[model samples]
Target chain A: MKKINRRQLLQGMVTGAGCVAAASMFGSAAFAADTRIRHFWWGNPSRDERTYKVIDLFKNANPGFDVAGETIGWGDYWTKMATQTAGKNMADLVQMDYRFLFEYVHRGALLPLDEYFGKTLHLEDFDKSAIAGGMVDGKLYALNIGSNSQVMIYNKRLFAEAGIEFDPIKWNQAEQMDIAKKLSASTPKGVHGIDDATMNPIVWEAWTQQRGKTFYADGKVQAVAADLESFWEYWKEMRESGAAPSADVSVANLGFKMTESGIVTGATAMSQFWSNQIVGVQSLMKDEIGAAMLAHKKGGMPGQFIKPSMFMALTRDTKNPELATKYMNAWVNDPAQTAILGLERGVPASSKVRAALEPNLTVSEKVSVDYFNAIQSSVGPLPPPPPKGAGEVNAAFIRMGTNVILGRISIKDGAAEFIDEASSIVERAS
Target chain B: MRKFFVRNLPGYAFLTPWLLGFFLLALGPMLISLYLSFTKWDMVGDPQWVGLAQYEYMFLKDKRFWQSLDVTFTYVILAVPARLAFALMIAIVLDKGIRKIGIYRALYYLPSILGASIAIAILWREIFNIDGVVNAVLINFGIQGPNWIGNPDTSLYTLVVLAMWQFGSPMLIFLAGLRNIPTELYEAAEIDAASKAKQFFSITLPLLAPVLFFNIILQTIEAFKTFSSAFIISNGDGSPADSLLFFTIYLFNEAFTYFRMGYASALAWTLLIIIGLFTAVSFYTSKYWVYYENERD
Candidate 1:
C-alpha cells in the first residue's frame, strides 16, 4: 500500500463525519415518521369532527409525532374493535366502554396503564378517581375520558298540559304511576303518558338497586324475585291503564334513539334517558325539555352513581404503547378538545378541563352538568358489568314484557319466565 | 418429467387460481371452524379442548335450538312449496299465448333479485308496518287490520308471504323447463281432446318434476338460513316471543353477541346436517316422483 498524505487523511475523516451526520439525520427522520399513532373511537359526525380537531391540536403540540383518528358508529363499535383486537391488529388508542372494559382486560386485550401514567405519562395533575376507574387486578388498563349519570327526561309542555307536577327526585313508584295515569287521562288522543323501555338495563339496574339489592352477587342474580316481579307489575299496570304505549308501540320503538322516541316526538310525556342524550331528545321536541332525577323506590337507597361514562385505553396489541399513552393523555388533558367534546361523552372527568370549559359552556352543557351534579349525591355505585349474554337477557326481557302486554303470557308468568330465562343466561355464561 | 410438466403448464395454470382460492379462502377457514367446533372459544382467549360439549349443549340442552329449528322448518315448509307452486303456475300462464311476455317476466323476477337484500327487507317492514300501505289499502276496502308486523301470530306469516312473493328465480327456471317441453306434445294432447288441466297434470307436471325438485331443495336451504329480514324487522331480538327466530340469526347471536363461538360452530354443523338430511330425503323420494327424460331405465 502507498503511504497516505496528511491532507488525504483529513479529507477522509471529514467525509466519514459528514456521512455519519447525514445517516443520523435520516435515522431520526424515519424514527419520527414511524412514530405515527392511530386512535379509534365510536361516535357520530359531530364527535368525529371534534375528535379530529383535537388530534390536530395534539399533532401541533407534539411536533415529532403523527396522529390518525378513526371512528365508527356506537352500534358497530365493539364488533369492529373486538374483531381487530382478536386479530392482533388493534389501533394504538381506543375509546372503551365500561361495559366491555372488564371483559377486554380479563382477556388481556388491554395494556396496563399504571406504569405509563406514573412513569411515562406523568399525569399527576389529572383527577385520580378518573384514572382509578380503569384499574383491574391492581393495574390501570384505561383512563376515564368523561363521566355520566342517568336521568329521567320529561316533556315540559305535556307535563304542564296534563296538570302533573313532575318531581322525580322525591317520587316513588306509586307517585310515578299516578302521574303517568293522570297524564294519560288528561292528554289528548294519539299521545301516550310515558314511553317506558323495559329492556333498558339501566332501568332494571336502578330498580334492583332501589331495593338495596345487587343485580349480580357471586356471579348470580341476587335480587328478590318480587322486586323484578313488582317492576314488571308496575309496567303492566301502566300499559293496562293506558299510562304507557301499547306493546306493539313499545316493540316498534325498540332500538330508536331518544330523539325518535314517542316521548320526545310529542307522542308521550315522559321517558328515562341518559343526561348526554338530552340534546337528541331536545332536537326532536318542539317544546322545552327538562331533566329530573331517576325515580326512586319508597324508602329505598337511591341507586345511582356517576360512573366513568367512557374511557380511552391502549390496546395490548399496540405497536407504539408509549406513544398511544401520550396521545390519550393529551386528548383528555387538552382544554380546547374538552371544550369541543363538551358533555357529549359525558361531563369532563379532568377537574382542570371541566373548570376551563365551564365558563364558556352552552345552555345544554350546563343542563347536563347541573343534572349530573344534582343527582351526584343520590347516585349509587355503578352496578357490576352486566352478566355475560346480557344482550340476550335484555332481548328476553323485551320479548317477555311484550308477551305480558299482548296477553300472550300473564304478568305473573311473564315475570317468572323472564327471571328464569335471564338467570339461565347468566348461568350458561358462567 | 420437466418436459411433461411444461407441456401441461397452461392447463395447470388455468386451475391454479381456483385451487389457491379454495385452499386459502374457503377450505382453510372451513377446516379451522371444524376444529373450533370441538373446542371452547370466546374469540378472545386461547381455545380450550372440549370435545363434543358444544354439540351436547346444542342437541341436548338448548331450548332455543329447538325453537330455531321449529321456526326454520315452519318457514321452509311454507315458503319453499308456496314459492315453487306459484312459480310453476306463473310459468304455465306465461307459457300460454300472452302479450308483453318479457315485461311480465321481468316484473315478476324483480323481487327475487332483491329478496335477500337489506334494503328490500327494510321496505318489507315499512310496507307491513302498523300504518303501512297494506293497512291503508285494507282501510280503503272498509276493513280494519291488526298490526301485522307487531303481532306474533301474523309476523311469521308475513315473512312467509314475502318469501312467496319472491318466486322469480324459480319461476324463470320453471319457465325454462316449460319451454323445453316440445309444443308438439301439448298440441297432440289438445288434439286428443285433453283439457288444459288434464294436460298440465299429465304432461307439464311430470316433465317439470326434476326442476321442481331442484327449486325445492335450493329454496329450502335458503329459507333455513333466513336472517336479514327477521333480524331487521325483529330489531335483532327475534321479538314477539321469537316468532321469527331463524337458525342463522340464533347462531349469530350465540357466536357474536353472547361470545359462544364453539356453540355457534356446533349450531352451524347441526344446520349442515339438517340440510344434508333434508336433501338426502328429497333425493330418495324423487325416484317415486321426479321423471328425467334421459334416464336409462
Candidate 2:
C-alpha cells in the first residue's frame, strides 16, 4: 500500500469538500424539481383540510399543474413570512392579514391583481365593499377570501337560566350590564357572568369605533388617553359588579384557545369573540352558544364593521403570475371548490359561493351565517388597513388591559405607557 | 514568502473548511449586521442607509430597549451570584465522604443537562402558574401564594430560580476544584489547631479563586443571553407589563415580529458590547483576588 503525504492528504480533503458542496447544489436542484406552486396560510387543522381539498380540486381540473399547501398557526405566520420575504423565497400564494396587507403591498411583496381582473380573474359575483376590502392605494393587491365582524358569544343555557328579555341587537351598554348582573346573580358560584376582557382588542376596537374614532391613522393611534380610561371604566363597572372574573382567573386564561378558555370550561357565561370563531367555540362546548354584536353605549354610533378574515395574494416572487391568479380565482369563485372549502375560513366573500353553500350548511353554521347577515343593517364601513407597527400596538393594548384589570397599574398610567410604546413603535417603523 | 507559504500550506489546507465557514457564515453576516445597524431596513424592502439613526433611537428614544436592558441587568445581578453561591454550597456538601456520590452527582447535574429546553420551560410555566404545583403546595400549608409567573413583581424571580436550579454545571466545576486541593495542607492546618471554617476561608476559598472567577465570567455571560426559557415562560411577548422582557427577546421581536432588521441589528451589537464589557471587567478585576498556584512573585 502506498502512503499518502501531507500535501496529498490536504488535496484529497479539499477535493472531498468541493464534491460535497457541489453535491448539495445538485441536491437543492433535485428538491426543486417538483415544480408545484405553493400556497401558504395561517389556520387550524380544520381549515388545513379544507384548503388541501380545494387545492386538489384545482389540480384535478387543471392536470399537470400541481399545487402544495402549507399551514402554520396565526402567531408564527408573519415571522415565517418576513424571513421568507427577506430571502426572496416567498410562497407562490400567501394568505394576507388586513393589518399586514398595506405594509406588504407598499414594500412590493405582493403582486397587484388589477392587471388580471378581466384576463384570468373574475369577481362579478362579489359585493363592491367585499371587493374593496383588499384594495391598497386604490389598486387591488390581495383578494378577500372571507368576511367577518366583531361578535359576542354567550351560552344559551345561562341566558335561559336568567330568564331575561335579551335583544343584543338593540341592547345598550347599560342593558348589557343589567343582563350580566342578572346572569351573575342567577348562575352557580363558580360560573362568572362574562369573560374579564373588558378592554381586549376585540372589545376595545369596537368601543373606539363606536365613539367615531379611528383606531389608527397616518401612523398614529387616533384614540386619546381618555378614550382608554373610559374603556377601563366601562370594564371596571363589570368587574366591580361581580360580573367578570378576578384578575388571577383572567390572567390564567389569557388566550381564547379551546383547551383552557373560560367559555368552553363553563366558567364564564359570555365571551368576547369574533364571528369567524363561532364554529370554533361551538366545537368545544356541549352547551348551546348564541352570537351577537358587542355592547354599545346608549345612542352610540355603530362600531361593528365587517372585516375580511383573510385575503389571498399572489406573491411577487411567484414564477407564473397568470397560473397563480387562476388558482386563486378557482379557490374563491369555482362553486365546487368553494363548497369543499365551506365556511372554514369565515363567511364567503362571493355572493355566488354563499348561495351555493347555503343548502349544505350545518345548524351551527346557519346560526353563524344568520348572525353575519343580521349585523349588516347596523354595521359600519370597513376599517382602513392598519399601520406597520399595529401588531405591536395590539400586544401593548392587551398588556395595558391586563395591567388595569390585574390592578398592577392604574388605568391612567397604563394608558400613558401604552400610548408611549405604541407611538414609538409606529414612529420608528415609518 | 514562497518558502513560508510552502511550509504552512498543509496546516492552512487542513483549516480550509473552518476558515471558509468562519469567513462566509459567521464573519460575513456579522459585518452585514454591523452595516445594518446603521441603516433602516424592514426585511421586505432594501436597506436604506440612515447613519447613526438606529443607535440614536436605541439610546435616547426607545423605551422598550431601556426596559429590556433593565430587566436583563436585574436578572444577571440576581441570578449569577445566587447560582454560584448555591452551586458552591452543594459542591462543599458533596465533597464530604459520602457513599454512592457518583449517582448523587449525576442526579444533581440532571437539571443543568435538561433545564435549558423548551419542555422544561413549559414545565416551569406549569410550576409557577396560578394553580401550579407551587401554589398547590402552598395551599397545603394554608398559605395562598401569589401568581408567581403572572405578577410582574415576582415573574422575573421564577426565571432567576430556574437559573439557580441549573447550578449543576458550576457545581461540577466546584467539586473538581475541591478535589484538587492538596490534602496535606488541610492536615497541616488541623495540626495547627485551625477550625474547619477557618481552613475553608483561608485555604479552600483562596485556592478555588481561579475556578470561581472562571465560573463567574461563564455564568454571567450565560445569564445575559437567557432567551428560550424566558421567551417561552412569558409566551414570547414578555407579558404582565414586559417584566420578563429579556434583551434577547426584545431583539427577536424587533427583528422578526416587527421586521425592524436595522434596529434589531443595533440591539444585537449593543448586547455584544454588554457581554464584552462584562467579560472584560471580570478579567480586569481577576488580578486582585484570583490567585494562581505556581505564580512567581
Q: Pick the candidate with the highest TM-score.
A: 2
For candidate 1, lDDT tens digit of each residue in A1-430?
A: 1222334433543332221101000001112235887788999776788888888888888898888787988866776676676567677788988878888888888888877756557566666766677787788888888887777888888888877775656677788888888998898986887876554567877888888888777667776668777887778788888988777777666565655577766778888887777766676667877888767787898766677888988877677887777777767776666677777787777777877887886666677777876776677776666666666677777777667667887767777777788888888876
Q: Chain A TM-score per model, please list them.
A: 0.87, 0.91
TM-scores for all candidates?
Answer: 0.92, 0.93
In candidate 2, stretches whose alpha carbon ends up further than 4 angstroms from where it belongs are: A1-35, A255-258
Each model's Cα RMSD: 13.7, 6.0
- CAPRI class of candidate 1: incorrect
Q: Model 1 compared with the native: what TM-score?
A: 0.92
DockQ of each: 0.12, 0.25
Fnat by candidate, in order: 0.25, 0.34
Q: Give the C-alpha miss distance for residue A102 in model 2, angstroms.
A: 0.7
Model 2: how far is A217 from its true place, Å?
3.4
Tell me the lDDT of model 2 at A235.
79
